[model samples]
Target: MYERARYWFDNTLARGVTALIGWLAVACLAVVIPVSALLVWTDERAPDTAWAKTAAVWRSVGQTLRLGGEVGSPLRVILSVLLALMALFYVSTIVGLITTAITEELIALRRGHSTVLESGHTVLLGWSDQIFTVVAELVAANANQPRSAIAILADRDVTEMEEELRSEVGDTGRTRVICRNGRPTDPAALTRVSPATADVVLVLPRDHPQEDAEIVKNLLALRTAVDDSRVRTVAVVRDAHCRLAAELAAGPDAVVLEIDDVTARLVAQCVRQPGLSVVYQELLDFAGDEFYVVDAPDQAGRVFAEVLRACPTSSVVGVAGMDGTLRLNPPATSVLSQGDRLVVIAQDDDTTVTTHEPAAFDESVMANRPPAAARPERVLLLGWNRRARHIVRHLSGHVAAGSVLHVVAHGSESLAAEVRAAAQAAPALTVTFGPGDPTLPGTVNEVDLSAHDGVIVLGPDHGPGQASPDDRTLVTLLLLRDRERTSGVPVRVVTEMTDDRNRVLAPAGAGADFIVSGKLVGLLMAQISQNWHLAALFGELLAPQGNAIHLKPAGDYVRPGHRASFATIVEAASRRGECALGYRTRGIARAGNDHEVRINPAKAEVRYWGADDEVIVMAER
Candidate 1:
């Protein structure tokens, strides 16, 4: 009975302020009334009559409880008690109002209910693993601008978003990151971030396939929230089928990048050239040489051949005419008339200066030997996943006829059917699927490592499961590396990982390449977010139908043991209808050296051309 009473009392105390006040008053009265009566009775000169003594005890209790205790007639005592009660009621009401006001204000702050009044800010909608990189890149891009701000609106808690961004992105420096709590798909909720007034709004995509529809809805909600059609918007969609819907909702000015197409293109390119991802990382980031459109008035009447050497600190890749059409690696005779912008690759916009002095080179040391013709190739794939079909199709498009791709994975009927469909889609190449577990040593060692030109290792989708996708990929990499060590064989290996931490933990060697799923998308989004023109530039660059970045033999341009300036290599490539960006040294990519890949070298910088060195260029082949 006592425990039950205590439990009931505890529940009542938790009810609210009214219950707490009632309990407090009962506690005070139980002790104060009895003590007051005892004091009055103990006094000798208290009251002679019984009625007088009772009234005196009541007066003492009233005075002790801070109610008015009048030592007069009954009417006077009753009026004083009434006045005291009114005063207590007024004070308690005022106190309750103030406490409520403070509590509501705190809750409003915690919920991020206030509207942002800043103009020309960047607005981000939705949340994903890409947020950290996007925020970090925004911080870097806004480092020079004063009082720049990035407002993020999502369904996550404001505090959680702030703390995670701080922990992942480190110091944001001058750029302020404001987080708001709301669903991005709701137009009413989207208004809190002021997307209409924002300079650019980015709609981030999540990992789930169903979230693609939500992203499209976000774009549509943005349409309802922002009346202005001029506001620039960038969105990402995982499925290619959803790209058209997202783009239509985003309007003509928006840029919608399909992640699957881009990922497939990158993986296909890396499979052929192990060192290509390194070049792309430098291109897509702000820290290194990237595409820039700058005026070249000085090269007005010069042919595109001479314009190649017009900049000492930059590489001229193409031109953008007044009509806004991009021309990458045009004919050698193409003229760079005044008013046409030069699409050059440089470390910064200011560095694309025209050099009046011509660069000197040793034409005597130039090699006239053309590159060997292309031949049929073979590829060995160790695993399969959602990206495998796209990889196979894009790889088939890049390789010559009679090329072969051998896939080894689980031989389940459903898996076999998927591989068979992908194989049937690529008519020019032959694809064979072998059933086995790639992580086992015998499965990898059974293949002839010397016959295949390259090997691709892909893991399953990353999430909660028996084991992580990264763990399986790393196991295969270790087995491949071990095979190379024991059998004295060398093979180019391209690995796909789901996590950045595990990507770094994977073993690295001369013929190994690592591609992180989210990191690449984050970098691409950041690049396009900073400069919208890059959207078209990257679109054309990654497409298989146009000119692409290629790493070619330095011996094909400049003979081995011959010294030449970068300008001479540029001229050599210009003769072949290509633009030479930079060169990579052989075996000089040790510590402190970034894999020996250098971009945007000065035109006058001379070096001894080695046979093993490769010249980076934009060419059709």
Candidate 2:
């Protein structure tokens, strides 16, 4: 009965009840006057004396005022009329608002663009920084289809959602975004966005502890709401151990992306190649060229070098097979089957070619030399974070044996031991934990960073309610630069930045590279949002299997008086079985100038040669 009453209230009575109630109120008022007059006449004829009659008239006048009039005399009658008019005005305004809302909803329904209490659309559960990124990607992915809609259901104000979208992502193009205000975990609230007809559901982890558990609960609710096995469901989980629980809750076909593993991998890559996160940025962002599947002509058992030279339009980075297996920059001699497709970097399908060279590199000019001599190392790890362990682990991989890692921080007991164990496990790196304020005096000097070859500052975690990490990073950079000027030591500093806002804060002369964590996640979601295969491609690049970004010595590509050309560098790197994509120059001595790390270098710059240019190379493992 309650359900039926609600249905009637929503469907039928909700529209016309206001007007009916207004008319009924008017009728009640119209009948009250006659009834009051009859009663007063009857009372006066039956028993009232002069004083009693006067008291009875006053009583009737008071009753009239209470009903809708003024308190005294004939002016009360005018007051009553005025009160009725005011009530009518209020009723009209309320009725108009309800009517407008209902009308808008009806029109939207008729156009098949919206629905109430759930219907066909992709429902994004929860709210976080990843929400905007998720929406933008979903829109772009479904852009080619006609009238594909995305419903965002979160425990946030719908108007705030709209405003955030406009400010962050302008012109959603052809995709329509509908915001539903409610908790995503509640079944009734979830119904507001219609989960039954949803093509896919993405349950994002909240930015809090027990986020993994929250995802599991949301998944369980989603399963109950939609029994359809065909609907693709994806969730984000914080811990590796929780991944199994989330996957079990989401079922076999559903994907539960483990946040820690992905983040760790990114941090590891950044440690190896300081600006690798930028590659992810350009690939994931909509403004630049993205990864693509371009068909390379029958290489006829040719080498990867020849195949790379063969692809004219797109920049070939990897290849995908019919069996869904992928290989990044597979060896030149690796046979290409007819079913295999080359993965290239291009803006779109139309912007690519099958067989052509990306400006020829003169082979004669290519110079291959022995590796540079090792220098004594001083490394400073400023601050502490979740990724700090992973960074230390990967950093230990490349350094010479017996190299010292000075960890300077207001050390936490839990993280301190973890860092110590990780570094001890590494064969080459010797770990030392020290207590010092990153933004304080005598802290950097006490560590003797002047003797250090490089310093790495780990950004703070965005976990739970932690303070913003950017300011600490900026202060550390400032302190380092001030000390470097006094000491005159060229200490290579690589730092982690949590927010993009702090990018300009560090002086370029601080001799450091910055890694923005949130931006990396944003870029990842953006890529997978547009093309599903990109997730796999990104995984391959980030993984330790092949052609990872490496910083090779400058002597491998250019000499002291050589005319600079990207083609020459590419040829040199190719001779070493690597792809030379870009370089970071050691030429910028003054702080705050361009750090001179160009990823996709222009082919025509003749005066850009430098002996200290670190070649960005991609090679088979």
Q: Which has the greatest TM-score? A: 1
Per-residue accuracy of model 1 over 172-192 as CA lDDT, tens digit each: 999999999999999898899
Could you tell me which residue pairs clash in candidate 1?
none
The C-alpha stretches of model 1 lying farther than 4 A from their native spots are 1-19, 22-89, 462-468, 589-594
C-alpha RMSD values across all candidates = 4.6, 10.6
TM-score of each: 0.87, 0.73
**In candidate 1, how many Å is residue 497 off?**
2.4
Per-prediction tally of clashes: 0, 13
Best by lDDT: 1
Candidate 1's displacement at residue 588, Å, is 2.5
